[model samples]
Target chain A: MKKILLALSLVMIGIAYHNNVKAQSEEELVQICTMVAGDAEYLKDFRIKLDAGDPPPVQRFPVVLKKDVKYRFSVCNSKDYEGKVILQLFDNNRQLATTYIVATGKDYPYIDWVCTKTGAYHLVYSFRDGKAGLAVGLLSMVGTM
Target chain B: MIKHRVILYQALIIVLLSQVLSSCSFCSRQDVDLSQELIVPDSVIQNSTPQVSKAITDQMMQNISSPVETAALIKGLKIPFNKNFLASTKQADWFNTNFEKAFALGLYGCDLGYLNMYEKTSFVVDYISVIKRLADDIQVGQFFDFSTLKRLATNNENLDSLILISQQSFNRIDTYLSETNRSMLSAVIVTGVWVEGAYLSSRVAQISNHPKIRETIGEQKVILNFLLALLKVYDNDPSMAKLITDFEPIKKLYDQVHITYELGEPEMIEENGVVTFKQTDKQVIEMDDELYNKLITNIQELRSNLLKL
Candidate 1:
């Protein structure tokens, strides 16, 4: 009972203190993403909460990517999170592209990849350097062209 | 793939052993060593609940892409909504075992996704009721919020909202199940959704000329292996054991599929606040027509078996 109460309290605080937490709980993400998904199609979505100093968790989703389809990977993070949360795209063997850039100092809301392959690919997600926050990653096909 | 196969082989050997032990009612046996490679990670989603559920669920949610997207692909393929293909709602009452309930919950989840995608608002109640019945049986009905979902479904404009809320409701159930140590049920729900989604695509691909559907079906080779590995962790349980054993033939068909990737340069582009990449990497699927037809037929059989119980 005490642990349950403590966990609830922590989540509440996590929401109140971190504007970076766009989603208070998974429920909030649903309501927000409903509006966010728009006319655009929905694909796979992942909700994650990160803590400081923890190696950004690598959650891998194995999906088939066909040649000629334009695939989009986007993130909806708490706006208060100052640091960029990065989403990387990797084919079975090689690292393809990431949602954020370091030297150019630009972080993208999403990564749009026109797949030339029709096999499985992995969409990996993480945050910068032990950054603490909650984010939802969305995969969609914006177009075929 | 060799390493994965080796891991699966070792895992299944333990599953066979566990099956033997359970058959002898070895629950009280002190000699039975319980240490096995658990797919559930030690920590997921900031460590709030039982680690077992989160680990398995994280692994699960990753592998099964939302069927809504598959519905979209079917739509993009210009395939019409064929209600005749969905598992019958009347059968929801037939499921007496937790195994059946979990699988039915999943079957209907895909049905709901398919319905929502086609904007077939009137038919939503059939699935929502069956899912509610299953969810209630599993003691997670509180998370479903039936009234709110009904309201969302009644309005045509809220179709998008309905899908989002449905996703949210399921996630809430995942959280609740993980916290309450009822994640085995969660595993079944995930599996049911995967099976239905796979079956739905196969059914549509049969008549549709979409190449994506064919490749997507072929890609299940890896996902199935991953799902079987996780399900085998609970092979000691009778229902889980049966599911694991029953799913082997599908895995055999998948074994014949050869998926290879030709590496290419990945390009990045940024325009008007949208950042996108063009993946030059291409995946080639090698499977003859005979194998593809056989695989689809097997998927249909599996789905049919699921609905029967």
Candidate 2:
């Protein structure tokens, strides 16, 4: 009877540990994009893009220009692995304006500053398996107006 | 020994009977019987051919030819002047020309709607030919026909003529639509009006320098009247009421545009033909998902009420 009880306790501990690990991985996948509204006068044609890579699916969301407008972009993952992601936006001059370090399971890994001029903008994002050094997904320029 | 053997036999029989009954229950688990209905005989099935009715064929033909019968089709369509000209004179010419096209298109759309509903193939074909001829004339800067315009002008005076014709057409086709079709029609009407209004508004913004922009302010007024009429019609129809409410965001956007830009009269052009105007940044409107969802839910409830009607 004692041995049976010991085995049951071990099983319960194993289950709990497994659940904790799963919860942690899920939390990491919930990372979202964030935005900060800068000076109102300088911003024009504010837009958001969601890029999920290579058959190249893109989603564009219009930016509403209110003083307190904030947004977050996120990629959801369904696995327990190191997620390395880069979120980038380029100005009309093809120069990078904002960049963010996005990791798997981190909240709001991507954020952008409000653009203050009327010109073309581009967004690009890449996600890689940190352990394998292989690209898992790439989403670029998800929105344009 | 006989009694013991008899009791054992009874027990064995009971156990077997129960097992058999349980297996039978499992076999008959499905609620419906599969073999109750007679299957088609192979000989009859081999000889059967699909029949097409004359009435259905006639209806299909009518459906195909109605659009061609109404409205003037334009030839060598030049892109309508964009409203971006800085000179008022240029803008006025552009707007006047575009307005004519828009009017023609609107009338054409109305005719198409009527013909589609009434299934009047010959009449539709004849009207479409006339429209095409008119379009050709307009392209060449020649007068095609103003008879339709004259008819419209005198329509109120001679209400019995066109009104009776329209009523007859509506009555013939109105009853044929299913509930789903009616719902779809409501959506189409709402979307159409919204798109047309947006298109007109954008054109107005482009022709901001045109003198006739002020003159054509009446078009916006007409749209508002049309919207009110539509709203009243939809108020009585719950399904349509829901769709109208979905368009509330667009209404608000229009209101903002009207207030911020459209309220003022056209700026007077200076002697040098240059109109001095300052460009200002307009804030972009954002749609809130939560609000839209609530609106949609309300519309669904409205639709349910309409369905009862």
Candidate 3:
């Protein structure tokens, strides 16, 4: 009985500690996201918490991009998580830009896109290795083209 | 019996150890419920329309342009700020319903943004007071930092902070409303902001006929689709249904404005570890004076009708 109770308490402590760390990382993500916004006019923000399936489907959000508007997409990921986020800007199925380059294995903190067409665009986020992660992203208007 | 009890205890220990390992600082891929990722909470569905998904609603809300940007663009045209363009705060007492209050709150917010942009600190007090009252009526008043805003509004040097804080307050309001399954109010508030901003831009374009202002006014055609879609999401509500009917004429007017985009090579420039993609593509707004005039007239007329509510 004593050993059983000890094991139960240990499990509870582990879960609580894990949750505490996650909450702290998410708070830090918001601050880093704001810092990434720099001098641009802050428009919209996405705070995403993802626990993916085996295949890890892309988490997508829609934004209406305007013509002649230069917009910035900035992302700050939680270092506590194993997953590194890949942020992509898509016009339907066609990829317009991305924060990570698969061939070069390079990553950027942000990507700036000068939208020439006024229409709906998708911001697709996914983890590098189909892992669970938490991230915050910002959409800011850089200036008019 | 003792042997069996020992085996049971050992099994329990194994289960506990596995849980602890799974809950370690680094998460593994044991959880795989994709259905959990896409759906809105059952609580949210209970309070509002059930058909629209949270993602669609989120997109709808994001599509609405921030009034701060509109005010800044108008200010950039170098036109003299017109106090007449703002909705009257005296009408605050007349609004009793949540629909009226939410819409009026948006109207006052846009006015506040314009005042903040032009650094008209004195005019901000009245708008802020009315907005606080309206927000309180809707039970979202706690989001606004009234005392801080009041202090900042009194000082011209704090205009930027005032604008940022004010925008943040509205954002908090939207977030609170959405989380509480009252996102319909959030949609209504943004609609109010869009109407007022379009009205301000239209009125200015009439006087100055600034090409930039005209182009901005023409750009409303794109935003209008998003606004209409958001309203349609809640059209089952009688008030929202009426608002959609009200916008039909303006929508018809905007339909005449045609925009075409020509493809060009995108230029990538890297500066100080930052990359910027500059679009060389050009967009042409093809609208004659007749249609532009009609659109402006209808927008002004609709805005006047909405303010009366």
Candidate 4:
């Protein structure tokens, strides 16, 4: 009976180890980014300089929006891990507009704002513990009533 | 002895049934003769550069003038496309038709069919090169130097040779359609039409705002329109009608994604001889996993049905 119990314990340990490895791999695939806009229709293009340790960033094209149109921006991880990302928005003079903390992999976390002003803005998105990378793309602005 | 005889009879019956079921060679003497007659000219044979045949050009013009006859010809031409798809159990008929039509329309090589002769020849290499080059050119970073329109007008011998090689390679793909594979073919045709149509349509939308890009966008529209029309026909098929109904929601999603490609979304402002307008990231996310999986399932079912046929 003792020998059988020992074998069962080993099997359980092996399963746990396998699951842990899988969870780690999943955690590595998470990606996060922040989008900022001066107006609802256009997202300002900002430069992203990845640290040497960061994974190669994937490029995205711009999403177009009309003036006064509500837009939402979110960050997502490709892996199974549920983590949090921070989004910081800045005006042309580098003044803070909004700061948001988004939970990744659930509830498409993004900013919903209508453009009252039309111009360029900068958005900075940072991830926790170097777990995710940032993606930048284009968006257009249109005049809306 | 009686039992042994019965067993032998059963075996014979099974063999006969298998033979009858397996035989799929439907090519008639006419088909063979037509294929044989499709001979390339010496110039075309020596150099892969497609030499436009005046005879074919005239014939094509005449056929185009007669809309009814042209439609009939297109319908008839679709037979080999269908047969090959059914036989090979590969939904490659749509691709083959595009290549064949392009070639027949003086876009590829000299038209052999104008002489009332069909050539059992292959232009796989040329077709592949043309497709690859076109795809590359349209890629985001100018991966290929020549655009689709430019490739159509390419007069270089080396490029022509490459195209010819590609066309030849395409011939190796068996396109014989069987009853079992029909469903599979239907699924593939649907998927191909959906993807290609969406791609070209979005590109058209992207260029719609630019006067300079209008011509390129128009050409893309033509291709997209053709793909959509083809999809409509397949959707009308009674046996595979369910697939089309199922695709309606996905098609709507595709349209939503394409809306992001609208041309007027960007404008140019000139200030002190410098022109700059607001540029935002435009990206369309792919269909969700559930939808994608459903589509894959439908395609697999179609494939399985075709295999049975």
lDDT of candidate 4 over B190-294, digit per residue (tens): 243233323222233332443322222222222222223333444555533654454454344333222122112333234453223333323222344454344
Candidate 3 Cα errors over 4 Å, as ranges: A1-27, A52-55, B1-54
In angstroms, give how far residue A68 of model 1 lies from its true place.
7.3
User: Each predicted complex: what DockQ?
Assistant: 0.23, 0.01, 0.33, 0.01
TM-score of the A chain in candidate 2?
0.32
For candidate 3, state the interface root-mean-square deviation in angstroms to 1 decimal.
7.8
Q: Write the per-residue lDDT of candidate 1 for residues A53-127, one digit (tens) a residue.
A: 565545455455545567777677766565446877765446788877877877766667777754445666667
The alpha-carbon lDDT assigned to residue B209 of candidate 4 equals 40
TM-score of candidate 1 on Cα atoms, chains taken together: 0.74
Task: Write one digit per residue (lDDT tens) for candidate 1, span B178-294.
Answer: 657777777788788889888988998788767888887887765565566557657789999889777878887887888776667877777777666776656678899999999
Error of 2 at B276 (Å): 34
For every model in order, the TM-score on chain A comes to: 0.70, 0.32, 0.80, 0.38
**Residues forming the 10-long window of minimal summed lDDT in candidate 3 chain B:** B40-49
- The positional error of residue B246 in candidate 1, measured at the CA in angstroms, is 1.2
- C-alpha displacement of B12 in model 2, angstroms? 36
Which has the better DockQ: candidate 2, or candidate 3?
Answer: 3
The true-versus-predicted C-alpha distance at residue B82 of model 4, in Å, is 40
Show the colliding residue pairs in model 1: A20-A78, A112-B276, A112-B277, A117-B282, A117-B283, A118-B283
Candidate 1 chain B, poorest ten consecutive residues by summed lDDT: B41-50
Per-model TM against the reference: 0.74, 0.22, 0.80, 0.21
Model 2 TM-score (B-chain only): 0.25
